[model samples]
Target: MTVRLDHRRVGLDRESLAAAYPSASASGRVVVVVFLHGLVETERSWFHRPRPGKARNGTDFGSRLAEDLAGTPVYVRYNTGRRICDNGRELADLLAELVEGWPVPITEIVLIGHSMGGLVARSAVRQAGDHPTPGLSKVTRLVCLGSPHTGAPLERGVVRVAGILGMFAALAPVARLMALRSDGIKDLARGSLHQDHRAEYGRPVDAGLPAGVRQLFVVATLSRSEGSLWGPLIGDLVVAPSSAGDRTQTADLEWLGGLHHFDLLSHDAVYGVVAEWLRT
Candidate 1:
């Protein structure tokens, strides 16, 4: 993940994928936990020290999740500028290949995605049914952290504001900065999963997740409560709680009182909830 986090290694070839992982136990059953990152972020962002420098906290999602859970932890790194559904389809194939080459027999596949990655994870799971990927049959759980299931209004607003700003002569530079978003971010504007993306790119439909798979949505907020003054206006500084975690699904909800979008990555409360869920 550290290497893949680099801009130079962003387009890693298939040959190098296996090298990213250390060998898992050869005999015992294993579970694969894939951590997909958010928009405009690298795999290293999950660890909280996004830059190339050494980490200060002496703790990270990779190290902590590995210690808390008995499984192989994998960080998925990709070009965030590309179409998310395209990446989703590629990820489905990549994961199947990973299972084929893994040392131990993988008993389960767990997908944890944040923001844009969540849409990719869901789309990948949907697309897998059509192509019949190897490891997909083992998929048992999906955890989406601060995902904008409905849409990412922030990205949408940025797009619109940039378009408006471009008309003005003096604000062209600011417009350029605001308009420097990727197709993946545009996809998040509507929260378009691969299936819906067919309308956008003339792609085919992707549907169905493994039946009875444990699905958990982790929602966070900047304000103390959703009813608070800033809660709906600026949820987690990116996604709304209603979008991150469906309030309707009372049984399947965990509400973190005051956390930003990236806070869920390596926070103790988040890890504890995930650990307990996996244990069950």
Candidate 2:
């Protein structure tokens, strides 16, 4: 019943590029930073996707973040198809395994997630629980960029339609396959996401963020020109800024103006703030 999309497609370029410029395995001396993209986007979208005329969202965010954190080690996650919980669990497991098996010592782990990726990172931290991998405890900061902690109201109609259709899909095979995207969205709506369960998403500060984790929310505010008919009124046209703030009063939230949903990742202004946060 869990939907897992093909991430292998997004990572092909990265793999080939790595092969072309293979570096020594990062010794534990490296500061490990993981970048997670939003839904319906691939890893290639972070670095390769080019807009013929205008500056696209997220295009430069990853590159700039990596460049700014030049001395530190970083990994950008490519998967965008699975349910948020499934992705979070997988990422948590992968990080635990990677850190434990790494050839060198890992000094720190920083998680940076944009939009839905932010929700997944928070969920993954919860999944890490007390049985956390030894080195993972060193994770000092979690940054959520343009994430909808309170859920976006614009997708409400789509969510409703998906729920009705999802009920019928339970009776048919092809229907289930056809409803994958909707189901995934529904799961996000029902799970510990910003839009659906504000309490669950915000509970981390006291119940899940552990002792020393510095939680930061980087909200992107978009203008009316950025979205379509169903675009958000207050957000990056996708997620509203109101939904991006902390409900638990534990996180330090900062608003980054003039960014579209994707611009939060690519724009220099937004990137500057993120880079500064990572350094601190």
Candidate 3:
């Protein structure tokens, strides 16, 4: 798994970083917007044009951020099979290296993650606090889109079904198959952010957001009205609104209706909200 800058492969080395962003060093101060994809997803997932015929090139969230916000977007591609905590630690180290090797001075860093990627971002922030990563100091904002901050009911249900199947000798193999899901997927069941805070198929630990960093938790619902009965029941057809973020009164949360979980990846409305937040 490698990190990409504007869709081009970029290594952590100074030379690679310089080559990747030829004009970055000349910029007075750079704002790096990092994009992390969800489970079983690659960096390209963020740039996917669902309606290619209607969408032009460079219209994705990252590209739009580059144009609308004048921020550099870096996409991360990692193995989703690993545990969230493990990936989080690795991401922290990677960001540290990126900052250290960057051609220009980093004024701020904004992390935008979708689904499990959001959990990875939160975990990385926690790991950075424990390890004192250089990049963590520059991170000004952390955004999670349709992340299961509480817990993902779908994953929980899967584990329950697997448990029931395991009780039957004839269905044991099927249960084992279900159990083969990656540790990353298992982490989603409880939205585990840290190793110590993890539970065995239980409620998610309420690990608070990092201090001083502007946090935004975006929830997407397939229903027309988030206040409707089906809104909370079928949130984006994957994560419920309650699971995506705390429903309490807070300025950090935003809700976008009539969108699915995957739609959060590249939807124009999603990008609009993110861009406005970053601008502020």
Candidate 4:
């Protein structure tokens, strides 16, 4: 019943991409921001909303971002099961169509990616810069929320565990199952995105960042005792601050305390900071 092998894609792929633009139905203000979800996530993940009255304890970061910008944000619903570079390549093509038939002239283009999505976004932007994508011309900003720009430490643990499991006959099946992670997940390895030259998943390379495109990284810490010994080890319980912040190379870093991985999605403080960035 579902179309496109993913979404209900009855129309042309280009048509689908064009239709996803926030400016398609809006007027004048043609600032479009594309929001990409993390691993194993889809467009629906962005629409996560809490109860009508519960704002503080809600789970709608995408919608909350729209409210902050006073505009709608475009959601990219792709197969997270695919390799990040593969998705990034497709995204580069899609963005061309997304803006080619813009009902209104696009004034600004922004990308906000979460986790693996951030890697994809980074890859796509690099490809766009090399290729001819209309969307790239107007790209002014890129914001990554809890994105492991360097690599995801948790994924390494999984790989190690998978390797260990394979050594036992009884756990071989479990190892195989765990090893079934998408190529995208495997690409989350250390320096995965730092390919000397882009090949596949090593995406919108921090090294290959387009000129004039402002980049912002936001990292969250869950430990109440950030200054303690295990603060870096327990950062958001997945990505370490050193990786998330990338402070040495990346100029802009925002560190927030008391938030986990998903918590970065809908945190009010984060929204406020992003909103201010958008305004400027």
Assess every candidate by TM-score: 0.80, 0.71, 0.92, 0.80
Error of 4 at 202 (Å): 13
Runs of candidate 3 with Cα error greater than 4 angstroms are 5-8, 51-58, 200-204, 248-251
Clashes of each: 0, 8, 0, 3
Q: On residues 1-280, what C-alpha lDDT tens digit does candidate 4 reach at each position? A: 1112134442324455456543455666777777888887766655555334434657466556666675546667777666777777787776666566555667788888888777777777767656757777677788888887777888878888999999999999999999987777777655345234324322333547677878888888887665857778899987888777876544477888877887666667777777787788
The digit string of per-residue lDDT tens for model 3 on 161-272 reads: 9999999999999999998888888888888888875666546565555677777899999897868988888989889898787654132888998888988888777887
Model 2: per-residue lDDT, tens digit, 55-170? 43534654454456653334455455556666776777667654655445567778888787787777677555645756457677788887766565455545455556677646
Model 1, span 44-84: residue lDDT tens: 77867432332335476556666667666777887777777
**What's the C-alpha lDDT at position 20 in model 4?**
53
lDDT of each: 0.71, 0.59, 0.82, 0.70
Candidate 4 displacement at residue 22 in angstroms: 8.8
Give the CA lDDT, 0 to 100, for residue 196 in model 4: 48
In model 4, the worst 10-residue window by lDDT is: 1-10
Off by over 4 Å in 1: 1-23, 49-57, 162-180, 198-207, 247-251
- For lDDT, the strongest prediction is 3
The per-residue C-alpha lDDT of model 1 at residue 50 equals 30
Local lDDT at 196 for model 2 = 34
Error of 2 at 65 (Å): 4.2
